[model samples]
Each structure stands twice: as C-alpha cells, then as structure tokens.
Target: MTESTPALPQRPWRQRYHVAAIGWTLLLAVLLVLSSLMTGANFGTFLSNIDQFLALLVQMSHPAWSYLHVILQPLYETIQMAVLGTTIGAVLAVPFALLAASNLVGNRLLRGLIRFFLDLVRTLPDLLLAAIFVAIFGIGSTAGVITLAIFSFGMVSKLFYEVIETIDMGPLEALKSVGATKVTIIWYAVLPQILNQFVSYFLYTLEINVRASTVLGYLGAGGIGVYLQRSLGEFNYSATAVIILATLVVVLVIDGISNHLRRVLL
Candidate 1:
C-alpha cells in the first residue's frame, strides 16, 4: 500500500548483553551435563529403575499404627531436647550477637574477630557436631542436646547480629545523647525494636533443631532417628511409615504454632 515503515535498530549494548546472557546459559547447561556424566548420573537409568522406587512406596503406604505407643517416649524426649537446647543457645547468643554487630560494635577489628569465631563454629556441619559430641559425651540424649545447642547458637547469633545491624539508629543515638550506658541503650533502644524479629528467628531455629535432633539420634545421640535407622535396616517399611507420619504431624504442629506467633508479633 504505502511506504513500509523502517524497523528500529537494536542498541549495541542491549544486543551484546543478550548475547552474553545466552552464552552464559549455554555454558551452564554444558557444565551441568558434564558434571552429571562425571558423577555417573543418568536420567535414562533413573527412569528405567523408577519401578523399584514405586514398590518401596507401596510398602510404606500402610503405616503400623501400634508403633505410636512405643515411640511416644522417644518423641517426647526429642521435643524436650529441642526446647532445652533452643533456650540455652538463644540466651547465650545475645551477648555474642551484640559483639558481632558492626553497628553496635564501633571497633571493626573486634567485630571481625567475633565474626571469624562464628564462621569457625558454623563450619562444623550438624552431623559432624553430633558425632563429635557423641564421642565426647557418650551415646545419649545429652550429646544430642549439646549438639543442638551449639547448632542453634551458631545460626541464631548470625541471624540476630544481622537483625541488629538493620535496626534504626535514631533511638540508639537518642539514648546515647542522654548518657545511657551500652547495656541500657541496647535494652531500651535496640531490643524493643527487634524483639518481634528475635522471637520469629528463635521459633524458626527451634523448628529446625527438632528436625536436626532426629538425625542426631542416628549417631547414638538418642531420638526417633535411631528407630528410623533400625527400621530401614530391618526392611520394616510399615514401622518406618508410622515414624515418618508422626514426625510430619509434629512438624506441622510446630509450623502452625510458629505461624500463629509470627502473626501475633507482626
């Protein structure tokens, strides 16, 4: 009909960026394939062997309800361990978190040292910690409790210090201007502002500790994991199913409580 409208030319920078993104994506895909090959991970093999997994699932479909009575004591022990460990760790983390907070601690060197210590603590995986504690404290719930406490301390301290760093400085400054002591300023200015966040994080840590305590039991730390290990070893899928269902119920209950508390605090 009329003269055709000319297409707008793409920007050189835009075209280069697009090409770079595509290149990176292709490289990533190639790396993934290479890594899978190196690890002997074959999707085709998994697809072919999937029926074995289905059979296992069928075995677990019917839970042994009577197993609940036997596990009640161990489950109670697990909950108690989580509560005690969380309390101990959370209480201990306050001073360490304050020391680690860059905003609170004016000395960069001191903050760095505290953070380094925290990093060192965090480097030890939970399973490794449990094993170490089990060796030191002997095989019992005591080792599990100690492991949970250390794990919670490392995690909660990091979370708390980050929260401290993000707090509004205005109240802190105001408190300082009134010649308030460090502890007083923290109690009045900082803690109030971050109290809700602290509770939320503490609850989150408690929930995690519950799951972790179960695993610690495998190393003779004492919990439901011992039973889980035994069930798998004995090929008792029915008992394993009951244990899994009970743990799921406990997790769901904790989650519900955590959600409710978070909503109230928020």
Candidate 2:
C-alpha cells in the first residue's frame, strides 16, 4: 500500500476545462430558462393542449378539391401582382445600388447617406406598409403592388450593392486608365459582372413577393388570401386546406423557374 501510494495520479493540466466557455454557456442556459418562463412555454401546457392541434391538423388534411376552380383566378392575380411589383423594384434598385456601393461611389458621405435611406426603408415591416398603403390607395391591388414594390426595393438594393462590391477591380481600373466616363466604365466593367447575379436576385425577390402578396391580400389588397380569410372566418377547414395546398404549389413552381433562370443566365 505504501509503494502504490508513492506514485500519485498526475494532474492533466492540458485537459483542463475552459472557464470562459463554461461561464458563457451557463449564462446562456439561464437566459433561455428565464425567457421560456416569461413566455409561458411550459412542456406541461403544450402536452395538455396537443389534442386540439392534432384534431385541427386532421381536419386540414382532407382538402375540398372542388374549391380549386374558384381560387384559380385569385391565385393568378397574386402571381401578376408579384411580377409587376418585383419588376418595378428590381429596375429602381439599380441606381440606388450603384450609389450605395463603396467601390463604385468613393464618396464615404454619399455612401453613408444612401445606406441610411435604405436602412430606413428596410426598418418598416411590409405588413405595416401594406396597411398604410391600403388606407391611401383604397384597399385594392394598388396597395399590394406598392407595398411589394417598396419591400422588394429595400431587399434587392441591399443584395445588389453587396454583389457590386465583390466584383473584380481590374476591369474598373483598366477602364479608368483609358479615361472612360463613369457610365462607360459601369457599362463595360461593372454591369457585365453583376448583371446575371442581379437577374438571379430579381427572380428570388419575385418568388418571395408571390407568397407575400397572399398575406397582403388579408388587408383587402386583392389576392387568394382574401378568400383564405373568408374560409377561416367561416371555419371551413376543408376549403382552407385547399387554399394552402394551392399556395404551396405556386411557391414550388416559382422555385423551379428561379433555378432554371439562374442556370440559363449564369
């Protein structure tokens, strides 16, 4: 026993716990627990209420196929509104993106101002904008179009400028050495590199607007969502299921088209 006790176990200093990481992890866990409590997110409550959710899901699973014909036109209108709004926004974003790009616009003050304006535009929620526009434009597709256009503008401009900033500087410098005008240099150097990416972003925004237009329709902005509201108000879960399924199909098609366009363009 004395001989065995002579060699004590060596401390593994190299394998010691990281105090800072442990402290941070514990702090994060405490915050999550506090947040869950404040939000009334107890597992017991969820378990008690789960039956109602399951019943609703079961009702929604059996869709009213006959309702499809009635919703087709409104679905078409939603797609039309998305296309118009996204086109308008994509076109308008070009100039703003050019002005905002650090590489393109060397003026720090100007870039800051443009970025600030864009931030302001993006700060407002699209639903709030739709409500405001609905009031002004009298609750029609006009309000929806304007709302989608402004929303698309904010998103596309930010994306476009980020793409522009990543482009090769060589062409830009080459054009400058030949004394090319700003427009000429952008046309020859910048546009060629970023145009395909711009098209890709445009299609992406269009896809999103297609879904958003349906939500905007809730405010009487004119789309399938108007019918969706009515179906829910009447508690016709079958019809509601039909609407949801149709919307999902539309979104899937948009995704396919966007991918095809990206491949062809790029």
Candidate 3:
C-alpha cells in the first residue's frame, strides 16, 4: 500500500477511430463512391433492371450442346494461331534477351537502349496491336498471328533477360578467363542453367497467348472469337455459352500440361 501505482488514462472514443487502417478504409470508400458517380454508375438503376439480367443469365446457362461441332474447326484454328505465334515470338526473343542481359552485355548504353525499346513494346496494348494488324492484314489468321507474335515477343523477352541476369556468374567468369569467345561462353556457360527456366516461361506465355488469340479473333483476326462475336450479335446466348465452355476446357487442358511440365523441368 506504500507504493500504489496511479491508473492509466484511456484513449477517447474519437482517438480510437484514428487508426491508419480505419482512415485508409474510409478514404477508399469515399474514392470509390466519387469514381462511381463520375462514371455514371447508378446502382439503383442496376437493381431495378436486375430481372432482365437474370433472364439473360438463365438463357446462357442452357448451352447449345449441338453447336459444339460448328466451333471445332475454328477452335483448332485458334490453337494453331497460338502455337505458331508463341513459337515465332520465343525464337525472336532469344537474341534480344541476350543483348538486354546485364551480365551478358558489358555495354550499359546498349543494355539501356534495349530495355527502353522493350518497355515501349510492352506498353502497347494487345487489343490495339490486334486492331492495327487487322487493318493491315485484312481480317484473317495473319493478323491474329502477327499480333500474338508481337505481344509474346514483348513479354517473353523481358522474362528471358531477367532469367539470364540471375544465372551464376561463376561459369561466365571461368569461360572468360580461358579466352572463350562470346558465342562459345553463352553456349557452354549460359544456356545449360537457364534452359529449363526458359522453357517454363515459354509454356506460361503460350498459355496466355492461347486465351489472347481468341479475343483477337473478335476484331476480325480469325479464330473462335469471330464466331463468338457473331453469336453475340445474333443474340444467341446458348451458342455463346457453348463457345465459352469449350474455350474454358481448352484453357484448362493447356494449363494442366504446362503445370506438369514445369514441375518436371523445375
């Protein structure tokens, strides 16, 4: 009793609400509300029109099973476009990747320029590429192929260079000490370590291109998406459902294969 401690003062209710998380949450909610208003998003109108949306959903649920045959050829074409495009882009990416790698390229100027060019390429949207190519190539798999090739190139080059830069400098140093040429060093010291990773990345990019190829066709680039656009224009929701389901199946299969290969390689 001779050394009794004083009671601690409690924070006020207003102070309790002064946490960083609460402040951030309130700010985010306010921003969302303002954005919605500015964008003409009327939730009340959406709620009122829910019945029509439900009806459309009900129509899509019952897919046209017999329409699967109609899509098979175009679906195969889509796969072909994806495969061709990914392969072309991957091949083109190798030299660019070698040039861009910091460990491989001694010239900072060259590396920086390559990186800047890559950044510019990567910034171009896939849709815009598709549209431009369609205008040039006149609506066929040619447009689709070129668009995918460019898209894949921009993506895969960056991935490859990053992989190259992370490789053990030990092999490179040893080769350089022995007076090995650049090509020999790259072939003997560089390729072996990064090959698996490169393949893994190629497979991943291929998976993305497969999906992108379909979308490109919607803009007259020639794939299953052409049929998809047609179906939507005709208001044939059942056919659209079938097309979507088929695309999902193909994507799932590719994903499964890609995952299995990655596991084995990695």
**Each candidate structure's count of clashing pairs:** 0, 0, 0
**Which structure among the candidates has the greatest TM-score?**
3
Q: What is the lDDT of residue 138 in candidate 1?
A: 97
Q: What are the per-residue Cα lDDT tens digits for candidate 2 across 167-254? A: 9999999999999999999999999999899999999899889989888888888888889989988988889999999999999999
Candidate 2, pairs of clashing residues: none
Q: What TM-score would each prediction reach against the true structure?
A: 0.88, 0.87, 0.89
lDDT, model 3, position 120 = 95
Once fitted onto the true fold, the runs of candidate 1 whose alpha carbons sit more than 4 angstroms away are 1-10, 13-17
lDDT of each: 0.90, 0.92, 0.94
Q: For model 3, what is the alpha-carbon lDDT of residue 158?
A: 99
- Model 3 weakest 10-residue run by lDDT: 12-21
Stronger candidate by TM-score (1 vs 3): 3
- Models sorted by TM-score, best on top: 3, 1, 2
The 10-residue segment of model 2 with minimum total lDDT is 1-10
What are the per-residue Cα lDDT tens digits for candidate 1 across 1-266?
69888988768985857988898999999999999889999889989999998888898998989889988888888888898888898988999999999899989999999999999988989989989999999998999889999999999999999999999999999999999999899999999999999999999999998888877888888888788888888998999999989998988898889888988988
Pick out the ten consecutive residues of candidate 1 with the lowest summed lDDT.
8-17
Q: Output the number of the lDDT-best candidate.
A: 3
Give residue 208's error in model 1 in angstroms.
Answer: 1.7
Itemize residue pairs with steric clashes in candidate 3.
Answer: none
Rate residue 223 of model 2 by lDDT. 86
Runs of candidate 3 with Cα error greater than 4 angstroms are: 1-30
Give the TM-score comparing model 3 with the true structure, all chains together: 0.89
